[model samples]
Target chain A: MQEKIKVTINKKPIEVEQGTTIYKAAKELNIHIPVLCYMNLKDMGIEHNPGGCRMCIVEVEGARNLPPSCVTKCTDGMEIRTNTPRVLNARKTVMELILSDHPFDCLICAKSGTCDLQKMAQDLGIREIPYQGEQSTYREDTSPAIIREIDKCINCRRCETMCNDIQTVGALSGIYRGFEAVVAPAFEQNLEHSPCTYCGQCVAVCPTGALTEVDQTNSVLGALADPRKTVVVQTAPAVRAALGEEFGMKAGTLVTGKMTSALRELGFDYVFDTDFAADLTIMEEGTELLDRLGKHLKGDKDVKLPILTSCCPGWVSFFEHHFPEMKDIPSTARSPQQMFGAIAKNYFAEKIKVKREDMVVVSVMPCVAKKYERSRKEFSVNGDPDVNYSITTRELAHLIKQANIDFHTLDDQDFDQPLGESTGASVIFGTTGGVIEAATRTAYELHTGKKLDKVDFKQLRGMEGIREATVDMDGTQVRIGIAHGLGHARQLLEDIKKGKSQFHAIEIMACPGGCIGGGGQPLHHGNSQILIDRQKALYKEDAGKAIRKSHENPFIQTLYKEYLGEPCGERSHELLHTHYFDRKKRWIKK
Target chain B: MSSVKVELHQKDVDKIKAIAKEHHNEPEELINVLHATQEFFGYLPAEVQEIVGEEMNVSAAKVFGVVTFYSFFTMTPMGRYPISICTGTACYVRGAETVLDEFKRQLNVEVGVTTEDGKFSINCLRCVGACGLAPVVMVGDKTYGRVSPDGVKDIIDEYKDAE
Candidate 1:
């Protein structure tokens, strides 16, 4: 065991483990030392305390000057004062200095209320800026998923850590120095020009308006306002698990019924569940996994083992940029969001006797990458997009508030029929290891032609970055691997590239906790416990369902019988499945 | 998804690969590899950085970040006669700003930018341990000490005649 140390903060002695940061020690004493750049999501092992922002500095006794408490380790009998007059003066001055260089457009800023800097300024009671200077400015960059407003960047480097250290995408880093320093792509290029995966993890970690999701709410509103448009909305499985946090409801409060009612009240002609499409994804993806497994078992040497799941658009972009050689290794199944869009336009539109152009399909997702995924040209037909637009969970919350809807007291309502019904397997898609578990549920029974004694794959579930399990498929051992963050996915991909992988199937989600911890989910503000709560809520929803298997869902069975004909059939291949591209060598000049 | 594609010759690419190999292709050797590559190529361009990233197993954005962080590195090529004015506190107090402004007026080039003719470029540097020289300017390796705003025209003329 490590040695223990005692530290005095505000004359209250507290014992902590050796090498404990002063900020953490103060927390034990319930002394809140406000921090800006310091973020600690201990559960995910992601801590970004650079001590660059001097906001968390405290007065250490006998020290020449105040030192940053977040990085400074505690020593025995060290006396620290966090709210001394000297410290407060220094902090206020530092805030003013930061504000001097920052744009004073808080009222009009996108992150006005939720901005950390704004909250810090208010908390410190900073009234005026005594130190005024020329504010730095840069051209705003708007990509399909995120917006880069460098002028609002405070140089905290949180996004830098998330982009390079966690996601391993390496699209953003600290460039230049001093007052001119800003996190940007190489050559100060636009994110679209860089190898950015559009994961939006950077946006999720950004404390200010420097990064934000591309607002498509206005266009969605425009579509709703159009008389010629029949706006149909699809809510992702992850959305319902966490959307309640925006309305002052507890995190992980399952608000599925209220969310559906709100969408219907928001003028959406039809409110469907993306979970329904998730069931369809399992049917198609599970069959593909079994087909590949069968081929490999028959000694088909050319067949790729460990068929990777292709549901995450961020993960797809990651491999397209970094591991283009393994592009063909991932299953060709489209994500549930895209599948729902394709079906809604081609199948559902025809069923309703409405032209595809007149049917506007909007998806409320827990991911920003879904916005980019829907924009891919392959998902379109003759200049018309399969999905009209993708809005984030935050955007949906804003829309609900804009419409003056009281979300908390609304009566629970069911989703519109035909495209609304889903199974327990689909609800679990919100959490890590869920897609593979759901796939295994169907593939195991299909492969062995035996009934599953218990549908739950207990071994295939957890929050680990990378997890492996071997299932006994009759007499065969079917190995399965699950990875949730892209960085973890990279390790698995590297092993596969080196022919070191032994698994037959793998599931990868770009976010840290599957879609529950997605980039476009309600801001958890680095509190990982919220993610755990969201994951628990999804499992609870799953357990409460009557049907636990995707193949057993009557609606999914009806979809196959009436329209798709069969899983991985010719029509399904055209709409539900898609191909991958080697984008490593493709560099477009602006 | 637009970017300016940077292309390099095969020989230069091979040289970069060799430098990376010399550093054992370790990601931690990124800065050292960049310095060596920059020493050979004069400046670290985007394409050269990309090649170094490929060799060193580091991201080009990260490499660019390190290259841009230190003021010693340059992305654009230096001119034939790179003019540097010391803008240290001592020099600035001694009217080095006026001298810098004169150079900009005469060369028609901003700091860190090369002239249209590619013969002259201007940049500001910290003190070169010549506090006695107060306001100093360097053309290539030749230092001109105690330079006044009036002497700015003479300095440019001297370099022009030499070229």
Candidate 2:
């Protein structure tokens, strides 16, 4: 092997392993070599990619031009000047080029005050571009959960990296040439018509306003204006835990009451909780797991092991496109977002004495794919979709701002009764491993005929990629696996494919750290621990709740007796249960 | 695979229906419907756009609007061999621009535009992490290092000979 290269960065001599980039070496010395696309490996979480923004330029003693420290490997006896004037000019020039066509609308952009590119430009003191050119204007793609305005794109390719490399869903990529270059789906197609799933992972990594959650407040207002329409809103469990961030609240602040009041202020007929439907989902899904486990025990060869959670639509659509054969492995749980939609049109419509056709069920979610999920046919019951519209937490923030509501001073309020009541177990559905833990709370107790020692399954919690734990219940050891992020899910699925391990149950969410760290959550910067802080707030909410299990939710118990009849009853199957289909061969283009 | 032959299951059909409802313009579902069709079939066929428009309660024009907005989706089947030239900073400074010019001349196609023969499609990339070998050109699965303008002819010839 070649000897390690010794490089001097800013008068300090450091020995870097061969193949380590200058940025990687500087990072080891705790030197901040200002970067636009150089995210730490841990910050990358699922998508650990190299620099693509070309903002971290550095000068090597013998090199002709500045090298992008992100991808350039260190050489033997190299003297690197990370803060040289030449390096500064190169980096500044790159930043200026990016801003030439960029729309300077940070004040209105959701990514404002928190965007990486904005911070980089501020650091570089790029107040004005030398070349002010006519910018390309794209009609905003105001799809259900995401909005795309291409003019703000720096073409950093971080969104493309995350979309293709991490999610394994190459939804957004670079197309065209020269000044006409842009990031978009093939043929500049609208995202709504694609299998994009509106996961908003692209929006999460976008350094500019080029990729964002589509604004639906105007459409929502239009619906509210029509006297013929009665709007009913459902708030997803994850949205409650993270929506506070938009109102200047700290990450993970539980503003459920405040959110409820805000929705009421928006003139909604009813403020329902998706958590309540989450409880219903657990009841149906937990029973399905138990039934499947029984079948697996009886030597049924067709039984799907490592039953993955389907609460995350990104993960669902991912399996649909790439690993379609594994579709049977995912539980037939139409995520809480969809469950609320199904029940709102059928049950809430009747309670409000409004026709199902006239009632519009709007969902506030911490996911973009919920928009895609709400549009799915299986999510519909009573000849119409249970939910009519889906908006992200960020979109709700925009709506609040558009309505000119004093969000910071809104008094906390409770959700409407009947469909709004939820258990502690349902609340935890916002974070990673929540579905598995919630299911175990009910499944473990129902099978063993004993209460769980503690509702807090610490082993399944946290932001780790793959977590494994074995629990002994009724003299039977239940092996469970929890994985967040699609990359990690791909690894665990590979292990299962190789017959490495057979998990009794597994939980998987497409975005990292499950719903609380969902693609549609408020934008955050480069701090892995910050993501964990957001995740912990969700567990804290679950811990504080009085009823900790889905089976223990009083409203769910009442619903079972009055409407659904049983967890896996005929009515439950018709309204709650769903199925998955395959599409792997179609997308396996090489 | 033809540009527009998609075989969709009930799940895909249902997803399109839900999209139609959410946009309050079942017509809006046409865009996503076309997207789903393209993902399923590798490209959108002209006939399916009409079917998608009808199913989702949107006009074919609206479907076309959606089809032209996002980047990850496509409306045409990719060529047999896809050539992605790196225009990332490191590669560009090392003369990747000349390599791109050579490919454009040789393939008779501009960046992002596939050839009429369907044998090759040339596209540019931000970066591919192989910056050590700057001015790199990727032809299908193979990566050519130290790609000079003159080297472009040999690389395309190598692919042709193999076929």
Listed in order, the DockQ scores are 0.42, 0.04
Most DockQ-accurate candidate: 1
lDDT of 2 at A585: 30
Question: What would the per-residue lDDT of candidate 1 be over residues A205-307, giving only the tens digit for each residue?
Answer: 8999999999899999999999999899999999999999999899989999999989989999999999999999999999999999999999999998889
Off by over 4 Å in 1: A585-590, B1-6, B81-110, B122-163
How far off is residue A129 in model 1, in Å?
2.7
Q: Report i-RMS for every model.
A: 5.1, 11.7
Lowest lDDT sum, 10 consecutive residues, model 1 chain A, at A581-590
Which portions of model 2 miss their true places by more than 4 Å? A1-33, A41-52, A58-65, A72-90, A103-115, A122-127, A132-148, A175-181, A184-195, A225-229, A381-384, A495-501, A584-590, B1-163
Candidate 2 lDDT over residue span B50-156, tens digit each: 34665664434334445555554556666677788999999999998998998999889987667897877888887888999997788767888889998888878
Interface RMSD of 2: 11.7
Q: In model 2 chain A, where is the ten-residue run with the lowest total lDDT? A: A581-590
lDDT, model 2, position A336: 80
Query: For each candidate, C-alpha RMSD in Å?
Result: 3.0, 12.1
**Per-residue lDDT for A109 in model 1?**
88
Measured with C-alpha atoms, the lDDT of residue A176 in candidate 1 is 81
